[model samples]
Target: MGMEHSILVRVITTIMPALVRKEIQDETDRITGKSKQISPIPIHLSIFSTNDIAQTPYYDFLILPVVNLTLIDLPGLTNVAVEGQPESVVKDIEKMVRTYIDKPNSIILAISPANQDIATSDAMKLSREVDPSGERTFGVLTKLDLMDKGTNALDVLEGRAYRLQHPWVGIVNRSQADINKNTGLSFARRREREYFATSPDYGHLASKMGSEYLAKLLSQHLESVIKAKIPGIILLINKGIDEMESELDHLGRPVAVDAGAQLYTILELCRAFDRIYKEHLDGGRPGGDRIYGVFDNQLPAALRKLPFDMHLSLQNVKKIVSEADGYQPHLIAPEQGYRRLIDGSLKYFRGPAEASVDEVNRVLKALVMESIRETEAMVSG
Candidate 1:
């Protein structure tokens, strides 16, 4: 149990953050009945004298050799297999490590994005084989060697012997320069539009035309569709129009055309929602049916008439049941049947709960105003 506790907490925390640091220490202390204590072991305990390498720049890097070391304990080889051979179980530790770490660009860095990618790739490769009983089996080993000149003292002390250097030198520097150039080009393009193309006079004209166009389209579409007259849809469209009007009322408003563009986007959204609602009501197939009504044939005749398809209504029901006979809704409410429509739409919009026309327009106007102010400041300052 002590070995198991240490292996689970120590190995996982090595990669993850210090959020679980206290929890792990508490658990370790509970199991071992030993309070944590700081050791005063000499930094160069592995060597007889540190004076020989004192003057070297690399000496600073070797102050603590093998600083953060962790050991993982895998009790037994249960579900283990080899690549391309499903029947082969790797009982040998050296063979398992060699197969896992030995590959093109196989040198694993201690702390890097590449480490995550490599670990995932290696896991996938190992997953190809199954245990002898045709069951999925795999286990993590105990030992890991993290060698990097930047963070690993062993690598710094040992130099080229332990440190795994990158294949192409100075690649990151070139990539950073390219990123900076792209950012500068984007900023220049934005400035040209703010100053030369859409000055105050033209910007206002454009905003008005765009807003009017969007408002007209929205009112027209809502009337044509939503045949039963959805009050919510109507309210949203009117609210959008009111928002556009409020923005126009602002004194000395610049880029009025861009304001119109924002209003039009709202109008188009109303049209889209109307179409989606109609389709949903019309029994258009939704993505990945959670509604188990399709499998109603398997249910008893009396239970089948229960309006709501509980299995389809809930997620993960299919996985819990062996066959259709075992299916049951833990909670069945008649009003909850249409709850999917509201939830689905809310998710689709990805907007705030108070997504009114005026708020959206105000938000857009503020954004445009900020952009204009920023460009002016950059040019002047």
Candidate 2:
């Protein structure tokens, strides 16, 4: 499932050119069908705006031969809105980046070109903000060949500068000129190796540098992270399987295939359900007990799942009381704080109440389904 260096470069060469841009109108017009950006039938609107902020669509590409890598190419980090771009574009991109990187599971790949100011790398800055320890962050330094005269990324390449848990691997990818000349990635890799081996500043560090090392490091990082998560994933999967098996056991055996048998089964199922319904009406166990459980069991279960303790912790309660006091401490209860706390706590009950109703509904529906399995075949057909 891993893509080799040559194959990866080939994919980049063919699919990952300078990013493709699309022209679009505003989201309001886009959704209202007043403007068709790209559609089967062309419909141009006169009131279309040049900068659209309403909708952002994800672009996906499928390569025939798959690799272990799954990439999410977000909008490039930028400080300014160039030319006709909307003013909010920068903030919007930063917000989107933050939403993804803030997640505990995501692995941040912070990349910067050698020519770019590493101190000002928005990608690394955002990564550090979300992952201050840099545990989940992997840094990449590209375009090592493009650095200014008499300068080298010796410190960064060796993890002495801008250190991350995973050290930065420097890459000397093909230039625009080489791409235009239709050079192959295998050839480009050879040149990359040659450049690193020959340069006096980077010659000794050739083993630790280049695209090959980056690919290996990335694969190892993903593997280690995935291995760490396997136990939790397996536990969830096993729990789901157990639940399914229990539900199946509750459903009992399947009905026969013969039409006559099915017809008889239907009658017997209806009678059984009727008997249970009558017993429940007469205050019996099978059906009547579930109704009692709605209040006694389901409601309590739902309440336990709510974060009442978290919301009403000592610190939080004190803060609320302080806020209610408004610069004056109360001798007795802060009546306003008590009222606010009660009101807030009461709102939490709404969810549990609704969940209890839903649980009862599920119990009823499941009972009905179990009683009517004879009709399942016809229904499915």
Best-performing candidate as measured by lDDT: 2
TM-score of each: 0.13, 0.54
How much is 180 displaced in model 2, in angstroms? 3.3
lDDT of 1: 0.35
Lowest lDDT block of 10, candidate 1: 165-174
What tens-digit string does per-residue lDDT give for candidate 2 at 279-306? 6535653666787789898788888888
User: What's model 2's TM-score?
Assistant: 0.54
- Model 2 regions lying over 4 Å from their true place: 1-69, 267-381
Residue range 1-381, candidate 1, lDDT tens digits: 121332232231133323343454455555544632211111211212232233456554232223332222212232454444234334443344434334422222222222123234343243323222212222221111222323322222223322222211100111344444443434433443443235432343232222233334434444443553578778889999999877655422343368787687556545655454444334462411322232233233434343334434555344433232334543544333345444544454333323333444554455445444444443333
Off by over 4 Å in 1: 1-87, 91-95, 103-381
The collision pairs in model 1 are 72-142, 206-257, 207-256, 207-257, 211-260, 290-312, 291-312, 292-312
